[model samples]
Target: MNFPRSIRWKLQLWYGGLLLLLLAGFGFTAYQLESARQLRHIDEELQQRLPMLVDSQRPIPGDRDRRQFRLSTRDALLFDQTGNESFYYVVWLKHGEPVTRSTTAPEDVPQPKAGDPPNRLRGDVRESFLFPGPGDCVLVGRSIAPDLAGLRQFAWWLCAVGVTVFAAGLAGGGWLIIKALRPIQTISAAAQSIATGDLSQRIQTQDTESELGQLATVLNTTFARLEASFSRQSRFTADAAHELRTPLAVILLQSQNGLAADHLTEEQREAFLATQRAAQRMRRLIESLLTLARLDSGELSDNRAPCELNRVAEETVRLLQPLAAEHGASLTTELAPAHCVGNADELAQVVTNLVGNALVHNRSGVSVHVKVLIEDQHAVLTVRDTGQGIAPADISHLFERFYRVEKARTTAGGHTGLGLAITQAIVTAHGGMIVAESRVGEGTVMTVRLPLALRGADST
Candidate 1:
C-alpha cells in the first residue's frame, strides 16, 4: 500500500490493526448475545399467548361440533385426534370414520403437510406452538417482528461508536510514538552534517540520563579526537617539507662545489667527505619521514607477537655501546623481564633512538641505564642517561622533527634531528607511549610503556 515512512504512521498501523480486531470481536460477541436474547423473548411471548389460546377455545368433551370450537378461538388453529386441515384451525371428526371439517378459519391458513408439524409453523419473526386435543387442543403463535428492528438499530449505533473510538485511539497512540522518536531523528540529521565535513557540528542534548543523550555526548568526544588528528597531520606535512629542503639544498651545493674543483688538497678531500656525511644524514632524515608517514597511515605491520623487553634493551645497548665508548661514556642496562605485543624491529628502533640521543648529547663520562618493569598493567622500558639535560623550555619540542636546542651538536655529527620523533611514531604504532623527563644539567630519562600480553598470548 506504500505506507507512510513516518513513525506516526507505523504506530498507527500497528495499534489500528489491533483496535479493529478488538472491535470486531466485541461486535461478534454483541451480535450473538442480542440474537440469543431476541429468540428467548420471542419464545416467552409465544408461551404466554399459547396458554391463553388453550383456555379461550376449550370445548366440551363430547360436543364434537367443529364450528363451536372454531368460532370461540381468536387467532389459533385446532386439530382432531386424526390429522387433518382445520380453521381458526378447529376440526371435527365422526364417530368411527376418518373425517375432517373446519367451520371458522381462513382458507389460506396452513394445513399440516406430509411430515410437517400437525398444527404449528416457525417463521423468521414468529414461533408457533401445538397442543393435543381429543380434538381438544389447538396451535397458537405470535409475531416477534417488533423487537428485530430495535436490535438492528442498536447494533448499528454500537458499531459506529466503536469505530469512532478506535480511530481516536489510533491517532492518540501515533502522536505519542512520533513524539518519542523525534530526538532520534534530530540526532540522525546532525550525524549527516558531520559526515559532510562539518566537524564542528554537534547534536543537542535534552535528557542527560537517556540513551540518546549519551550518544550525543560520545559523538562530541569523537569529533574532538578527529579534529586533533587532522590538525597533527596538517602540521606534520608542513614541518617535514621545511626541514627536508635545507639538507637537500646543502647536499646539492656540496656536489656542485666538488664537481667544479681541480687539484684538490688532502684537507679539500676531507671537506668533501664531510659533505658526503651531510648528504647521508639527509638520506636518513628522509627515511625517518617515510616511516612516520607509514605509521600515521596505519600501513606499518600485519603481525604483532609477544617480545621480551629485556632482550630488546640488551640488544639496543650493545648497538650503541660503541658510540658510548667513542664519546668516553659507558653504556649499561638494568634489565628486568617483561613481555609486550609488538614488532621486534620497530621496538628495537625506539630503544636505539633513546640511548643514542643520550650518548650524543653527553660528553662527561655518561652512563646509559636500561630497565624493564611492570607498571599499571603495562610493560615499561626506560633509558636514562648522565648527560647535559634539556632546558625546561626545550623539553616540549625535543621530539619534533628538525627541532634542535644546540646548533653545535647538529654541525658536529650531522644529526638529522628526527631521532626522537621516529621513536615516538614507532611506540605509538605499537599501541604504546613515550615521554621524556629532563633537568637542565643532571640528565635525560625517556620512558616507553606498552600493553602487557596475558599468559596464553605470550606463548606465541
Candidate 2:
C-alpha cells in the first residue's frame, strides 16, 4: 500500500498498527483464560462425582440395592467390571461403553475405548466417561453439556466494545497530529503568498526560541536587506544622472560657439575636436547611468523574440574592432550558431563593453576573443581578454556603476568606469546574467547567460 504524506495520516497508520497489536495481545490472553477455566471446572466436577459414586455404591437402607446417582438431572449410569452392566435406567451403554454410566445420557453416547480413557474437556466437545475400579460395576458416570449460547453472545459484545474504543483512539490521535502541524502549514502558505510580491507579509511567531519562530526571524532579516539595497541603488542613479548634466551642457555650448566662429583655424579645429570628444564621453556616461538605473529598478524588457546570438556577437566585434585597433589590440571571434530569446540590441551592448574594457585597461598587446555557444540549456556568450587581468577583489565590483579596477588606467584611457555596469544592466534587462572570471596573472573572461527560449519565464 502507498504511504501517506501528511502527519495526521502517518499518525493514523501508527495508531492503527498499535491498536492491532493490542487487540491480538488481548485475544491471546482471553483464549488462555477460557481454556484454563474450562479445564479446572471439568477437573472439579470429576473429583466430586468420583466419591459420590463410591459412597452410593451400597444399597440405601430404605431403597435397597439401587445406587443413589446424584447426577443432577445429567445422564447417570452404573456398571460392574468385566464389561458387564449392573443397572441401566436413564442411560445406556453401547459398543465402546463408559466404565460408569449416566441415566440421562443417550443410548448411543460415545465411550472411551478399553484402554483409552477420556481426558478433561480441553478440546472439541465429544461424549465420554470413565471409572477407576474393576468390571463395569465399579464405574459410574453421567453427561453434563451446559448450553454456551449466552457466553458466546457476551463474547461478541466484548469484541464490539474493544473495536469502538480502538477506533476512537485512532481518530483522537489523527486530530492531535493535525493540530501539531498547523503552524507549518500556515508558514508555507505565508511564504508562497509573499513570494507573489507581498513585501509587507511577515511570519507569525508565538515563541522566539522555537524553530518556526527562528525561520520567521531569518525571513524578516532578508526582507530588510533587500529593501536597503533597493533604496541605495535608487539614490545612486539620481546622483549619477545629476552629475552628468553639467558636462553634457558645457560640451553643447562649446560646440555651438565653435560653429558660430568667423574663421576656423587648425588650432580652433583641434580644440573643437577635443570639445566634441568630451561631449561624446558625457553622453556615453549618461546612457550608461540610465541603463544601470533601469536595471536596478527592475524595469525589464518584455520583447523576447528569437535572434541569432552569434550574429549579434559578430556585429559587436566588427563595431569595436577600430577601437581595439587604436589601443594596439587584436579583436577575434569564434561565433557559433546559437538561438535565444532576448533583445538583440541589449546582447550587442554586452559584447561591446567586454571588448572595450579589455582594450582600454591593457598597456600593450591586447587580444579579445568572443564566442557564442549553448551550455546546460543556457545560451553562453564568453568574452576573454589577453591583458593584465583584474584583481580578485576588483572583479566582483566591476559591474558596479563607476567602479574602476585601476584609477590610473581610467584617467589615461579616458574611461568613465560605466562600461561594464552598462553591459551588466543590458544583459539583466533581457533576463540574463553576467559574471567576470579572473586571476592575478591570467587574463579575464566575462561570461553572459541567456535562456535558450524565454517561454515567458524568468531567468535561470
Candidate 3:
C-alpha cells in the first residue's frame, strides 16, 4: 500500500480518521441509550396501567353472571380506540379464555397465564401482565409506534449532526496544518536559492524563541559563515596567482637567456634547459589556478556572443590533433549546428579539458570521438573514449576539484587534476549540467547539456 507523500495529508488522514471513528462510536452509543430509554418509558406506562385494569373489576349487584357483572365496573377504563397510542387490557381465567376485555384491546392478544412475566413486547405493542385473583389474570398494553418513529428520526438527526461536525473540524484542522508548515516552505526556498551559488541567501525567522524559528536562525548564521569563508578563500587564490605571475615570467626569461649563452658548457646548458621546463610547468599551473579562481568568483567571459557549439568543437579538435598523434590515439568528430550563448574561449576551454582529460588518462590506441548536436531544445556535446572505464565508486567524485581516478594507464601529458573542475565551473556559469556514465570494462561517456540560444541569436 502506498501512503501519501505529504506530511500534511498524512496527518490529516490520521486525525480525520480518528475523528470519524470517535463520532461513529458516539452516535451509536447515543442511539442505543435513547432507544433503551424510550422502551423503558413504554414499560413503565404499561406497568402503571396494569394495576388500573385489576382495580377496575367488580360484581354486579343483582346480576346472576359474575363475568357480566365484572364487565360493568370498567365503564371509565374501556373506550373505542382512536389512535395507535391507546391503552387496553385483556383478562383471562385459568381455562385460557379471556373473561373480560376492554373495547380498545387488540383481538389477537393471547390469553396470558397468571404466572406470566410482568412485561413483554411484540412488535410495536408493549404489555404488562398481572394476577388480580386466584383464577383471573390481566394484561395491559399500548401501541408504541409513535415512540419508535421518533427514535428513528432522532437517529437520522444524529448522523447528520455528526457528519457536519466532522466536516467543520477537518476544514479547521487543514487550515492549521498549512499554517504550521509555512515556515518549512520558506526554509526550503531559501535553501534552494543558496544552493544555486547564492551564498548570500538566509532564512527569515519571525520568532527567535520558537522551534522552527530557532532552526532558521541557526541556518542563517551558517550561511553567513559560509559566505565569509568562500569570499576569503577566493580573494586569497586570486591575489596569490596574480602575485606569482611577474616572478614566474622573470624565471622563464632568465632561463631562456642562459640557454642562449655560447660560453656555457654542455652541462650548464642542460641545467638551464631543465630550469626552463620547470618554470614553464609552474607558469601553466599558475594559469590554471588563476582561471579556476576567476570561475569560482563568478567572473566569467566579458564577451558572451552567440556561437555554434559545433564550431567550438571543431576548433578544439584542430588544436589537440598533435597531442592525439603523440599518444597514438585516434581523434574524430561528428558535428551538428547547435547554437548557444557563451564566450567562445570559455566554451573551447571546456571542450579542451574534456578531450585532453580523455586522451591523457588513457593508453595508446584509445579512440576518442567528439559529438555536438541539438537535443530537446538544448545543445548537447558528448566525449566518448574507448578506454578502460572509471570505477563505480569514483564516478560520483569526478567533478570535484583535484579528483583523479587511479587507473592503470600511461600519462601522455601533465594533468593538474583541475581540468574537470574548471570545466564544471564554466558549464555551471553557462547554466548547463555535465554527467559521466561508465562501467568496468566499458568505455566512459561524458555528456554536457546547455540551454539553446534564442532563435534570433547569431549562429553565423
Candidate 4:
C-alpha cells in the first residue's frame, strides 16, 4: 500500500496506532475486571440469603407432620423478600429430590446433585449456590443480567471517550509537528533563494546544538565558500578578457595591414586573412566573457529611465533583415508600444541576440517572427522561428557559457557559444526573465519579460 510520505503524517500514524492499541488493551482489562466483580457480588448475595432460606425450615417429628412441616417451610421461604421475582431463586432439596421451589424459580433449574460444588453450573447470565442445611440442602441463584448490561454500557462509554481523545491527540500532534519543523521550512526557503542567485541569503540559526541548526550552519558555510569561489573566478575572467582585448585588436589590425600590403604573396595573404579571422573571433569571445563577468559581479548600474521595447525590437529586426534575407528566411515584426526601465542599448542587444540566433540556426525558407507587447504590467518580447527545433536534452543548458547543441554547427558559423549566456545575464540584470520553449521538429520560441516602468510618459 502506498502511504503518506510526509514526516508529520508518519508521526501521527505511529502515535495513533500506539494509542489505539493501548486504549483497546486497557478497555478489555477494565471490562473483564468489572464483569468478574459483578459476578462475585452476585455469588455473595446468594450466599448471604442461603441461611435465611434454611432457617425457615423446622424439624419434622413424624411422617404425618412432614407434610405440615413442608407446607410451613414453603410458606416461610416463599414470603421472604430475598426471593423476589427479578432478583433471586430459592429451592429446597431433600434426599436428592426437590421438595419446594420459589414462585420465581425457573423449571429448568436442575435439582442439586449429590456431592455437587457449592457454586455449580447454572449458565452465563445466572449464578447458582448450594448450602448444606439440617438434613437437607438449599439452592440459591440470581440473574446477572444487570451486571452484564452495566459492563457493556461502560465499555461503550470507554470507546467513545477513547476515540474522542485519539482525534484530539492527532490534531494537536499535527499542529505541534508543523510548529517544530518551522525552522527547517525557513532553511529550505533560504536555500532556494540562494540557489536562485541570491548568495547573500542565509538561514538564521538560534540553536546550534540541534540537528536543523547544525545543518543550517553547515549550509551557510558552504554557500559562503561557493560565493567566494565564483567571485574570484569572475574577477579573473574579466581581468583576462580586458588584458587580451588591446593585443587582439592590434593583432587583427596588423594581419589586415599585411593582407593589404602590395608585396605580399598569395599564400602569405591567405595566412594573414586566417589570422585576422582568428583574432576577430578571439576579440568577440573576450568581449562576451567581459560582459558576463560584469553581470555576475553586479557592476552594471541599473538604468531606471523608461525605454521603449517596441522601438528596440523594430530597430533590431531592421538591422538583421539582410542576414535573414541572405539565409532565405523572412523576418517580420509586430511591434507594440511597451516600455520598461532598462538600458536602451542593453535591451536592443537582447533583441539582436534572439533574432540573430533564429537567423543563424535556421535553414533557408524558415520564417522568423518578433513581437513586443504589454502583458500583465510587463513588457513582453517574443521571438519565434519556424526552424529546426532544439533537442530536448540540449535545451536546458543553452544558456550555459560555451555550451552548444553540436560542435560541427558551431564551428561552421565560428560561434563562441556565449551569445545566449550573455543575453540571459543582461535580462537578469534588468530584473527580467527569459524562457525558451522548443520541441524537436516543431521550432523554438524565446520569450522575455521585463517589469514595466510606471513613471512619466513611459506609462502611456
Candidate lDDT scores, in order, read: 0.69, 0.66, 0.85, 0.79
- RMSD after CA superposition, every candidate: 18.6, 11.5, 4.2, 4.4
Tens-place lDDT digits, model 3, residues 102-198 = 7788889976655667788888888888776677778888889999899999999999999999999899989998899889988989999888777
Tens-digit per-residue lDDT, 209-303, candidate 4: 99888998999999899899999999999999999988888898899889878988889988998998889889888988888898888776455
Question: Which candidate, 2 or 4, has the higher TM-score?
Answer: 4
Ranking by TM-score: 4, 3, 2, 1
Task: Report lDDT (Cα) of residue 314, candidate 1.
Answer: 84
lDDT digits (tens) for residues 227-285 of candidate 2: 57766876687678878788688877888788678889989888887888778777767
lDDT for model 4, please: 0.79
Find the candidate with the highest lDDT and give its number.
3
TM-score of 4: 0.82
Name the lDDT of candidate 1: 0.69
Which regions of candidate 2 fall more than 4 Å away from where they truly are? 1-247, 263-279, 407-410, 454-460
Q: What is the TM-score (0 to 1) of candidate 3?
A: 0.81
Q: Rank by lDDT, highest first.
A: 3, 4, 1, 2
Q: How many clashes in candidate 1?
A: 6
